[model samples]
Target: MKKNFYHLVTATLLTVVLAGFSSCGEGKADQQAAASQTPSLPVISLPVKTLTGYQSYPARIEGVINAEVYAKISGYITDVAVDEGQKVRKGQVLFRLETQSLNQDAAAAKANVNAAQVEVDKLKPLVEKNIISEVQLETAKAKLKQAESAYNSIAANIGYGTIKSPVDGYVGAINLRAGSLVSPSSQTPLTTVSEIDKVYAYFAMNEKEYLNFIMAADGGVRDEKIENLPQVTLILANGEEYPQQGTIETVNSQVNENTGSVNFRAVFDNPQRLLTNGNSATLRVPKTYTDVVVVPIESTLERQGSTYVYQLDADNKATATEITVKDEINNLYIVSDGISKGDRIVAKGIQNLRGTTTIQPQETPFDSIAAPIKKSFR
Candidate 1:
């Protein structure tokens, strides 16, 4: 009985030891798994504040003056004085047409004018002395007038043979080369001329924008009171901004039925000849409000149609903030509500981030990322 009791005790002790060891191994494995998991919070840098305003919009550059040079007379091109991309002045000779027929007609008319003058001279004395009837003198005078008219007509036609530039501009490709036949009625242009010293930027706005402008103006919103009105900037094709600023030249009186938008035209001085007609560019205009809160656009996130940003709390923890973005200024969002100027908001690494996540905040180089944001907002 004693030996049986000893064996039972030994077995019981071994079972308790194995159970405790198994529990410890499981706890250690759980700890390892927890340590290997990725952190929910992503580290990011915040945007710094600067005392500047920014506005960005899609814009296009265009030539203020675009012309299609056409032949005024029907003849073979005798001479082409300008080539493609050549600069020309107003009244500069661009091309010459075969003027042999016009020249001969002018000479013939001059001869007739001379003959008629001699006849009028002889008849004038006769009429004055009453040597011939008034009808004869009148007939001589009528013939002289007819000859003069013919001479002037032929001289004007001859002048049309030399094609002169109508404006000071750069010439495009010469469609008709020397020895090519041309005419005033031809469908093809002889060349194109464009004045690129200034350009016209055109855009369209919807009824909402149009009505807002009208209401603001009618409500006694003065231009000076508006923070960033009356001034606009443009983006070129190469993504470089045009240095010169522009103003609202004119707004079309009517809205387009098909597009449901109002046409707007703004003039920009392009001294470098960078802007051309039919080239695409962006036109950015600023719409400002009083005492509005704004946040960096990079801080905002969209989920299921809702826009939000990660705002830091007093504890340095992230709190998701829902914002009503009134407008996007440069690279920032103009928040009508939900955030203030001094709030610490995450501006980078937002794509892989979520609400309530812990973050290691890092200060981004103000010069690098801020440049694009400043440009976008301004």
Candidate 2:
């Protein structure tokens, strides 16, 4: 009985020791698993940045003066003096119409004028001698004037056969060819003459944009605002910036009801003849934000139409805070409200974050967060 009791005691002690060691090992593992479950976050602080950026709008390029060339008379096109893309001057003949019928009309009218003039001379001599009534002489003189007027009218019509350019410009597409009949009432013009030495870029702005532009300009009144406007940039269709700057010329007097937009015209000097009529481009209007608050866009989150960012509090815990964005420049937002300068916020990983989420705060440079935005914004 004593031997059996000693073995039982020894076995019980060993079992208790093993159970205690196993319990300690499992407790350490539980602690380690709890530590590994916490999410890792990278963070940075928001800083006040003055961002200079542009707002782009679609633009239509055109010549300063685009004149439609038209034939004034009804006739077959006898000759074409200029081809498409040809340079022409004012009063330069561009086309010649067949004037054979008009020539005949002028000849007949001239004969009538000659016969009436002879009668007038004969009647004047007879009236001076009182050989016939004065009424007859007066009638002959009137006939002479009518015939002269008819001849002049015919001559004028003949002159209309020659179509001339109304302005100094480059010729556009010619819809009518030699031997094609053309008339003044034709809907399609003969061709277009575009003065492309200088070009006009046409763009539109809504009511809100117009107000912003008027308020942002340097002057007080509308006219002064137009005159004192800053130089604008032109982005061509090929993604190249035009070397020369452009100036705003005119704005529409009234808003277009159909489109709810107002038209704006800007002029650019084309020293290299690079800007052409009917080309598409972009107009980039620049604005400088002075001492405004800004943050990387990746740091923001949209919830139920509000923009929020993960801002760290005193405990390094991220809290979802709403922000008012004034404008979007590149991939950054100019925060008009909410986050302030020197405030800590998560630079990225907002998608993985929620309210009161703890983060491992990592210090990052302001430029490092915004370098890509500045470089690629252009």
Candidate 3:
């Protein structure tokens, strides 16, 4: 009976060991099934869209006429007739100098002129009566003419004391005030008169950029090239775009040696007097690519200063490919080469994945993804 009990115990132990091995084998099989599952990633097909890119440069704003007002004579400023930013007409009185000294000089000159007139009248009678020699009468008349000329010169100087506006425009700054001494040789101008009905925006481009601008234009002559240039936009100091569009008017004949840049002038109409002299702004010139292949900026990866995108094949295998980017606009890169239309690419979730990773692609609409990004940028 004891022998029979030992056989039964051994059989029970053997069955328990076999069950443990079966459980371990099933657990590993489940883990392997989970690891083999493919990750689902968003993918997109390359689309052709029109994109416009802008190149910005620092710019200076000035009125069409930046006329500097200077004093023509030496005197103390007695009266400042106009204030800063006041609208003025041509020939309007701007300032008046102390004319007391000039008035005294004119009085003395007038007395001399009266004395000369009396001498000329007496000489004329003597010459007609033949009482004095004709040569003596002629000499007296010449002296009278000289005296009259001196008196007229003094009177003209008095007129110069009242300074007038040289042009019809708005006043800029009042440098010299009442009781301040001014002269023709003064380095600073009394004021600036700016014609702001139209304004000019000056900007510069490097030598290579200028050459490309001229050569890409559809004209043979310089004037025609300027005419063919697209209208540019002005970004004000506050980062707001100006209401008016500006046209390229003139280009400097020679490039600046010190800066190695060519200057360009663009004109804009200022109806509400919003622009003024010496205002700072930015000039934005646009270039458009029509029906070009573009990729979203979010899908791009920068590796060593070069842009890259993961391209997908028919078997859903990703391969990192380098693309040539011509420009960027609205959160998209204008693809010039390397990838073309109808090409499939991994849109997002590429951080963990590397070369030759097979994926289960979840197709997403390209426009739906791009539209939101474009709106945010705008």
The TM-score leader among the candidates is: 2
162-205: candidate 3 lDDT, tens digit per residue: 99999999999999899999999999999999999999999999
The 10 consecutive residues of candidate 1 with the worst lDDT sum are 42-51
Task: Give per-residue CA lDDT, model 1, range 307-347, as digits (tens).
Answer: 89887776656778888877665666667677766677666
Error of 1 at 220 (Å): 3.9
Which lDDT value does model 2 have at 278? 92
Pick by lDDT: 1 or 2, better one:
2
- Residue 368 shift from truth in candidate 2, angstroms: 2.5
Clashes of 3: 0
Write down the TM-score for model 3.
0.87
Deviating ranges (above 4 Å) for candidate 2: 1-38, 375-378
Worst 10 residues of 3 by lDDT: 369-378
- TM per candidate comes to 0.68, 0.87, 0.87
Would you give me the overall lDDT of model 3? 0.89
Q: At residue 185, give the lDDT of candidate 1.
A: 88
Candidate 2 lDDT over 301-356, as tens digits, reads: 88899999888899888889999989888888899888898888888777987568
